[model samples]
Target: MKTSGNRVWLTYVLSDSDVPNALTLCFSLRRVLTSRRLAVIVSPKVSRVSREALSYGFDFVFTLDEERNTAGLENEDFVKLFALTLQGFEKCVMLSPNMLVVKNCDELLDKEEDVQQTFVFAENGDSSILRLRPSLQVFNCLLKQLAKRNGTGVDSILKKWLSDQTSQLTFIDDKYNQHLHEKASFLREEKNIAIVNLKNKTPHELDYVGEMVLQLWKSIYDKSVLPLLNAVANVRNQLL
Candidate 1:
């Protein structure tokens, strides 16, 4: 597949079950006309079928090496560290698959270029969205730190790591990573909100905000993702 650009938007899927969410996120980014290319890192648990489906939506579909696929949530967080090892990209915005991009967020890439620090995170301490300048040195350093601080929450580990760094941590606005559990009034009034992190909750489980976001996600899936998935499936069957 062709590269979208030097800067890319990225997500990760640990298993086949996460494919639908990842596709929705990708299509949402496209729907918002995000200029950056899209990419995903899939764990070994994600099957070939899922990877093929992802390739239909993403510019790059990366698989985590088997050795890096350790167990537990901490290990799962460890998988995300691979984003730093991506060689070609000068900058990458890593977002959770459960997030929906509601507005054009190309500014994130532009803003990141101005920052002196190598990493950008939401001020609210949500690791759901991150902007990073990918480097093998940074990735290896974090990997060692993570190993030493095993069992710590990834957010905490990251905060501690940044605290010790010579460069100060740069923070993105909270509107870019709004959580689903925020007050309904806040969700409704936030006109500048660029992305909504669903916290893994389904529409039926949430209030009005959930339904509204779910409708948007469904619209993208039905109008964009579903058709592409169908086409990919048909081609796969024909090849078989």
Candidate 2:
């Protein structure tokens, strides 16, 4: 699929139980999306994503079929589940599997300067169940794998935006009769954790965006539109 000048594309990755989540996301998203395309990456095990998603004319639909490529390697854990999803695209306006698109996002990718190669994402706080608190071993494994890649920026981009340390220590687990997480202390300060490339300077700060609007635009333009443009330019596709 040629991506040059394709406009923005909404990319989503869904699991088996996420069929309803896909429906909710797509129906609501269609109303707000004017210029971009919607690309859904679904688990092969989930038939609903393919069946129910047909009417939307998604720009592309991919499946999570691990049998087709690399597995068991250290990088597999980080990119394994997503490889099938990112099959043909280079850049994307990605959303969490559970996010809901409430407002129009046509010009959300509009950029300022040429700094559109950066990836924009929100931080999942320490208290957030949505964020993964990987074991030290898992952390090291992923870190080593990321180190070998070319400017993937996986490690620096992810941050443990912590929540109020004092409040976190206040909640005692009824079964254990003590705080499950470590008590707040100077060594284990949990607030004001900064996000990489973002203006996450304080507790009230939103996740670092780092010329977010611009970066988002770049991602959309490069991943969704640029390849299409190249294809058309080279006459790679007869339809173009």
Candidate 3:
């Protein structure tokens, strides 16, 4: 579950046979990530190529059962397994395969030594942060009302963006965040992404799809939310 001194203090949750992404992750991060810090959780069906590829870079490997869930995709249990690693490793940083870090990703490793949260997520201006921004609340409310009227499909999009991954928002961060929320609090409202924003006068005023969903989830449920606030933030603080 934990590593003694792996370089990046990172882990990846994935099943076997996803060769293309695996290869991409290995090579993309290899130059920056050392052999000891990188690891992959694999299903038993991991191809020999995957195994060899992993062995070439990762310091740790976890083989898991392929038939362990509602779907082969990772879930809460998968998060827990990786969380266990965090419990032991302290500054552990976990990422999915599709997540690509183009900046100071190496800084996440120092989370423990400095006790600061570090991670960078692409800023999609249309994200749910608009709801919390205070300036956009009126506009967002107006947009939601229009959605209710025309059924054009832009309803509370982020709450349901990744329902499969975040069916509910957990209550763990309350103590740190002053106990302002509860478990199973936020569920993906599940809406259509093709909706347009008549609220915006300009065509370029809209945010992208991720801005609608995952960004919202991050606003509400990202206890470990990416902490890339400014371009100058010590990215090495978060882990590359």
Tell me the whole-model lDDT of each prediction, alpha carbons only.
Answer: 0.79, 0.37, 0.34
Ordered by lDDT, highest first, the candidates read 1, 2, 3
lDDT of 1 by residue, 1-240 (tens): 424488899999987778888999999999888888899988878777778889888999888765652333344586567788888888888998889998998888776343456677788888889888788887777777766665677778777777677355668888888876676644576676789887765555566665777789889989887887788778878989
lDDT of 2 by residue, 1-240 (tens): 644334344434435454444444454456555566666655555554243443244656765454533323333134322432353433444444334344454433443221221233232222111112113343344444544656544433232112221222122112111111212321232232111111122223222332332244345445543453344435534445
The candidate that wins on lDDT is: 1
Off by over 4 Å in 1: 1-4, 68-75, 185-188, 200-210, 238-240
Go through the candidates in order and give the clash count of each.
0, 15, 14
lDDT of 2: 0.37
What tens digits encode model 3's per-residue C-alpha lDDT throughout 204-235?
33334323433433342222212222221344
Residue pairs with backbone overlap in model 1: none
After superposition, candidate 2 runs with Cα above 4 Å error: 1-7, 48-57, 68-90, 112-118, 123-240
Give the number of colliding residue pairs in candidate 3: 14
Q: What local lDDT score does residue 70 receive in model 3, on the 0 to 100 scale?
A: 26
Give the Cα error of residue 9 in candidate 2, in Å. 3.3
Candidate 3 Cα misplacement greater than 4 A, ranges: 1-13, 33-36, 65-80, 83-88, 112-240
